[model samples]
Target chain A: MRGYTSDKDGYLTRLRRIEGQIRGPQRMVENDEYCIDVLTQIAAATKALQSVSLGLMDEHLKHCVAEAIAVGGDTADAKVREASEAIARLVRS
Target chain B: MRGYTSDKDGYLTRLRRIEGQIRGPQRMVENDEYCIDVLTQIAAATKALQSVSLGLMDEHLKHCVAEAIAVGGDTADAKVREASEAIARLVRS
Candidate 1:
């Protein structure tokens, strides 16, 4: 979270792999795999997605929001509000 | 993407399910499953995470950034820069 950009390559690498992962379940379902088997794959995908979300949130909080606050005043307020709204959106999502 | 807040619940629901998904692979690994089988599950998880990332980015673009720009001036400039940096970070990730 310190330098969100620093780990960009890693995150993208993981995301690219996940793009492949999404396709796996589809092929399984198309092949008429067992319900439980399909569900398990779906579950796995969902979990991986959550990790990305959490990571992104941390980056936003630790870097973006923190920087904005350092500047202080309206920009800081805006950044804080923006982060709160985003967090709310993420939580609700 | 039109109204990020509107779909917040849906996003969260998917994410919550993903949390469960993450655990599935762990159990599989612990069970000493075949390498291929474990990989497939991992693939599925990665795909799901990507979908969420895309959705979040879309929401940020269509809703959050849009609102900040509408306000205009320094806040608008700040929001736009923040978003561009975020997109850059995300792409790298």
Candidate 2:
């Protein structure tokens, strides 16, 4: 949380770039671009998205999760459940 | 990016919960808990991780990637490349 303010700007900047990537395919679709080309763009967008997620997950583990373990309280169990549920959703997706 | 500040607090809280969940398995391992239990916890942690990644990815598509396409510049190509590389890493990982 302490570092949140410091990192927020960079995170948002990266996200904005990613948002543009996501929209590329939609535009392609609207223009009736080649099937393979649109699919390729879609694939690219998906990967870009996964990258952002990976970075966030890494931060969460290092900061929030690590802190919870250090503190050792009810928060610990809640964190575990929260993480587990998140993983389940990812795999399903 | 504008929405970043608005959502920051909620995101941090969720991340903290995930952080605690990640450490649960580590503790279980250190305490010599049941083998199945440890593995189960590890699996849970992984799932939680995936969930966090998925959520962030979803947001990136909605925000960052989407916005880039709207702007229509060299950023468009850069965004596509950035996204593609990220996906490649995820699939490999």
lDDT leader = 2
Could you give candidate 2's per-residue lDDT for residues B37-79 as a string of tens digits? 8888777766666655555544543355445644646774465
Q: State candidate 1's TM-score.
A: 0.48
Could you estimate the TM-score for every candidate? 0.48, 0.48
**In order of the candidates, what TM-score does chain B achieve?**
0.84, 0.80
In TM-score terms, candidate 2 sits at 0.48
Q: How many residue pairs clash in each candidate?
A: 16, 24
Q: Chain B TM-score, candidate 2?
A: 0.80
Looking at model 2 chain B, report the run of 10 residues with the lowest lDDT sum: B83-92
